[model samples]
Target: MERGIIKIENGEIIIPDTPVWMTVGEMSDLFMVSAYGIRKALRQIFRSGIMDEHDAVRPFPYAEGCYAEAYNMEAVVAVTFRINAAACRRFRELMLRRFMEKSLDFYICIPAADCNHRTGYDAAQVWQERHKLS
Candidate 1:
């Protein structure tokens, strides 16, 4: 199977508008690991019950007469966490950073009046100061 292209910019991974489903070979290329390594990680991921094989993987027609096993985004993330490689580390870090940013954004959007008074701290000010937002 041909490897799908993964784009990264300014240390952030860029996902395509359309959902991507990649075969083991494609994931190996994208993660800069051997196909065997990907399979190994997938085995562990499934064995640990982190993801269900039926939900995470599906067979897709890659050629006129052949079908290959392809993994969805959730499976891809699970595999990334299991793999030990520079690409995997970078992916994990970027995903965590994005999650934290989103959480902070949500918190900051809440008005100071809505913030919990029990903490005796203003959540909005704290977030703005920490993020260096004027």
Candidate 2:
């Protein structure tokens, strides 16, 4: 089996929104490591706050809202950033591959006409102004 993160392009991966949350199995497969190790690394990353916003990684109902687990895209990225040293080239490579696949293609379009304030500007433009994306 392909032990790697199921990217958005794969269509089988769970991505309810733009952040791209992945399950422990997906992360473990992506990193080619045990789920326990991913959890350990996540615990450390959570304390850092650079990735995890809260004390515990937010739980997401992935499997048809029947189950929930610590599923945060930012947390995964943060954990990868910390341990992606020379010793973990494979991890870095996987990250690169995932990113290189045009993950940003999944864009959220909010019609400007629907908003009362903005008439001509698209949601993406407003987002750029607020977050300085451009």
Candidate 3:
């Protein structure tokens, strides 16, 4: 949280390092709501001007000459903030839980050698030798 604003180093909600894409139908299923309802809520969120249509909705190819409304995490987060639905709240909670889990995994998995290697050439030399990257 740099300067009191939430900044995700890698804002990939699903795979941690990969972009997350969610179709409107899928989100409706997750939220246990109708697809039209979800779409309406999203449109309201968009009208608030927190995010642009490009950032919120995208064309997702589902079949030949067919496209569906797909949303990214940014849009989902914004919608969750504006709505008071229980399902939306639950979705936000799950997202937060997953984000925290991924973040913890990232910190725990950083190699000690790699951490030391950033300090000096001597450490880098040692790290290289130990990892056989020389």
Candidate 4:
């Protein structure tokens, strides 16, 4: 969603302790960021050195041991559609391999479901296909 900064109103209801927490489905709809983006951001933060045992710079926090960040529509619209889905597929491994590599101060946070990535895959099938294929 939002790439650089996230602002919250005072007393905002925090669903979870992370930067932003919405259902994986809700995020896919509201911001046009697919579940893959959410999943990627989660994995990215873990790998990006942006997180700690308590909080992550990416904003994802978990009640249990998992965490995921929230993003804004504008921030997620920058990924090249032709590669957003593929980008997710590509970076997923990097996330795991580079887990704790270093925290990224900012990311384009592109949406694979956006126009840029329109050429990459069918929008409706963002959730249908698994991202493991290379």
Winner by TM-score = 1
Ranked by TM-score from best down, the candidates are 1, 3, 2, 4
lDDT per residue for candidate 3 within 71-105, as digits (tens), equals 88787677666666786786677678876778443
Pick the winner on TM-score between candidates 1 and 2: 1
Off by over 4 Å in 4: 1-20, 53-134
Query: Backbone clashes in each candidate structure, one number apiece?
Result: 0, 4, 0, 11
Give Cα distance to truth, residue 115, candidate 2, Å. Answer: 34
Models 1 onward score TM values of 0.68, 0.46, 0.55, 0.26
Put down candidate 4 lDDT per residue, 11-122, tens digits, no spaces. Answer: 2311333334344445454334577866565555546554442343345454687765544332232222222454433434343445567766863343555543646665
Q: State the TM-score for model 2.
A: 0.46
> Which pairs clash in model 1?
none
- TM-score for predicted model 3 compared with the true structure: 0.55
For candidate 3, which ten residues in a row score worst on lDDT? 1-10
Which 10 successive residues of model 4 have the least lDDT summed? 74-83
Identify the superior model by TM-score, candidate 2 or candidate 4: 2
Stretches of candidate 1 above 4 Å error? 1-6, 103-134
